[model samples]
Target: MSNIPFTLHTQNSAAINVSLLYAASSKYEGEWSGTPHSHPYAEFFYVLRGEIDFQAEGEPYSLHEDDLIVINPDVNHTERPRGPGTVEYVSFGVEGLCMDPADSGMWSSCSLFHCRQSRSEVRFFLRLLLAEFENNLPNYEQLCCHAFESLLVFLKRAHPQELAVTAPKRTARECSAVKRYIDANFRQPISLDHLAEVSQLNKYYLAHAFREYIGLSPINYLNSRRVEEARVLLRDTSHSISEIAGIVGFSSQSYFAQVFQKAVGESPGEYRKRLRRGRQEKQE
Candidate 1:
């Protein structure tokens, strides 16, 4: 048991300010040693390396690699390494930020216990947070804050324990599978019927469940995904508009341009030129 007081990283302090109390990373070897403590600030932790045996307000929980846990303000909690292997993680605290209890609005609702069951979603968020922590770019703190809020919302939908009404017992699980599929196949033409068949649910039920839990219908979500891919292509690749459009599942460049403008508020070519100019100005 090592009595290491959590070390705070100060690099982000200027941007985060005092309202965001602290952010730190730690690795534990062999045991649980820290005092069972509670803080006035809300705390969020992401396990990056190994498993941790966590005890929060007398409830036992285990967090594996890529797992996330949130301890709301003043929740008594303690954690120890699950084994001899090292447990590495990052944590941050938020002050003067609290959620309303009755909101129960998916993950946005205030709750003492929130956990992420999806490894991919947890990993995605951890990488995003690590990027912000490592690179203190302008507005990185705000990016991290938004990412944290998104994480809470994701956990609310991904974690069964936080759900208010009973969804069919496997609602979250099936939704996770469906989401992963969409993420993987977003660039391809994916149909709602196919998505429903893949998830083993009726189309109408799948639509309702997906929107209720993931906040997007299959087709609308797919188009949004295609637009996101298009933005990446526009900024990072030299592929022609038609080529990029086809690659991202859009049937025609004209159609893609219209959708991109609708979503991004500018034509793809215009957006790309703006980004290039912004980069050039930065270099100047």
Candidate 2:
């Protein structure tokens, strides 16, 4: 399967390397007050649960769960809970990337950028960042740098108009409905009929459009999504190999092992064991 290349716009210029200075998580309830302030470091935050009314540079944003906001260096912003329910979020203080936020057109109009449509991608990298930050495994700092770079791509994709003049954005949206459907229901037995029904297009037409938009057939994309979720479970949970296989929609443990090894270049059990070993070695 072809991979989507996500770049950070480092062409013909010195690349920016970001470092994670501090990372923490908080869960709060009820109405709260925020202290408006600015710093020399960039900060990334995600609303893990509940909602918040976030304000930055005099603009008010009502953000719900999964919403992301990147606060530029030395820009003032604050977040207050929107309702009574608890709001859990993870945040990181970053340095080295925001030396001059104005170099990127996104920070010109506003110091805080909102990423509304990239919750899944952002969370994926954010999870890895937190994991690496806490464990301090070998090459963890380098891994966090790459995670932050992926986040830059998500930010760029979320608001392509904010990119530099020389950089062009190529995005696919015509078959987004099919992709979203598969992501949400990959655990079920899915067929071309189900995909076409969900996309409101003919099966053959949907196949051509899906392949054009994402460079993968509908079934292939489905398998990829399942495999991605399986990796998360393997890294974070204590589930057995067979249980994880079933949880991620594979019919049997052996088939799941084959697909996962082909895609990830290692068996699921081996990968999980390696990750855990590396993590424990560094943490200890």
Q: What TM-score do all the candidates reach, one by one?
A: 0.48, 0.48
lDDT of 1 by residue, 208-233 (tens): 88776556787777888899989999
Minimum summed lDDT over a 10-residue window in model 1 is located at: 1-10
lDDT of all the models against the reference? 0.67, 0.69
Error of 1 at 15 (Å): 41
lDDT of 2 by residue, 1-284 (tens): 11112233453474444446776778887777888776565677788888888875556888777776666555566888986888999887765444223344222212344555677788888888778777878877678778877876776666555443122111123355466567678888888888888777889987876775456889888889899999999999999999998898888999899989998999999999999999999999
- Cα-based RMSD of candidate 2: 17.6
Candidate 1 segments whose C-alpha is farther than 4 A from its true place: 1-170
